[model samples]
Target: FPQRYAHSLFVLRYRTLALKELQVASRKGARNLCSVLVKTIAEQVWAMEHPQYTESRKEPVDGSMVGIQMGKTKVFLRSRAFQQLESLRNAKMIDAAILVQSRMRVFIARSIYICVCSSI
Candidate 1:
């Protein structure tokens, strides 16, 4: 289930590239397609899990940064920072919802057009 979910997310994010590869593979009967997909997913997951340690990531210049802060006993954020973070997250959610809705509408419209054309 997790793999399927991840694959769907990956394909959505890289729709053009994924579609091109899929078309080519379908036409050519690529034998290593599964290995390529597994490798790509593993690389993407690893990149997310272990972001490279750059100079900016090494330390924040200011003490009052607006992100997650970890302490010896607990993890916490300032109220203002938390509010800002929540708003940012909500914005991303809305954007993703909009994208999904637009895609579904396009799919439905295309299917309806095909049906009408085929009947004629």
Candidate 2:
């Protein structure tokens, strides 16, 4: 029982650290993906800690609002930085599109293009 308790505490601490890393990455201009991932992970952790709430599978709007407010207070990511990251993401998307189109043209005879750009 003591070993299990220690393991649980270690897991919780690891998750807390992972969340902090995600917040830092988001502030460093990984806006959309990082923020969404962080929120989902946080909600999941909250649900796990509160088993009673798990049965409902519904997040309280006020709870989320409060969480958002708390997150804002803890980490401030400037709008300009977010916009810059967005622009970079957009550019990568455009490049991916171009690559896909080129691959399509090349594989036109085969009628199938399997170009996969993993860096989104």
Candidate 3:
């Protein structure tokens, strides 16, 4: 039981460290495919690779991505810097929604036209 408890504590610590690394990467303009290099011990590296502690299933709303690339002695964390305002993000999303709706309308109209021509 003690061994398991120690392992659990290590996992939590490593998870927190990973999150902090991602935050630092995002702040430091960690753009492109690969970014911040996080130094970790062997046990921490193992924890970072663990399925339960490694992957973040839900994406954060700020458009930054959390991805990890393990190296020989460091973990590379990739994330985008968040520099835009909330209003700007909302505007961009609204534009995207409009574009999608317009495309869908066009598709529906074309399908209806095809159906009518076939019937005639």
Best by lDDT: 1
Task: Return the lDDT, model 2, position 60.
Answer: 38
Question: How close is every model to the real structure, measured as TM-score?
Answer: 0.46, 0.31, 0.34
lDDT of 3 by residue, 1-120 (tens): 111112223333333334556555544443311223223222243343455844553432221222333443333334221111223345556887999999999999999999999999
- Which candidate order results from sorting by TM-score in descending order? 1, 3, 2
Quote the RMSD, in angstroms, for model 1. 13.5
Candidate 2: tens digits of C-alpha lDDT, residues 1-120? 111112223223223324555555554543343344435444544554465866776643332332321243132223432343345446656887999999888787454333343333
- lDDT of candidates 1 onward, in order: 0.44, 0.42, 0.40
Query: Which numbered prediction scores highest in TM-score against the true structure?
Result: 1
Model 1 agreement with the true structure over 1-120: per-residue lDDT tens digits: 111223333334333323444555554433333323333333333333346733234432231333333333333445554454345446667888999999999999999999999999
Could you give me the TM-score of model 1 versus the true structure? 0.46
Model 1 residue runs over 4 Å out of place are 1-63
Superior by lDDT: candidate 2 or candidate 3: 2
Candidate 2: residue 13 lDDT (0-100): 27
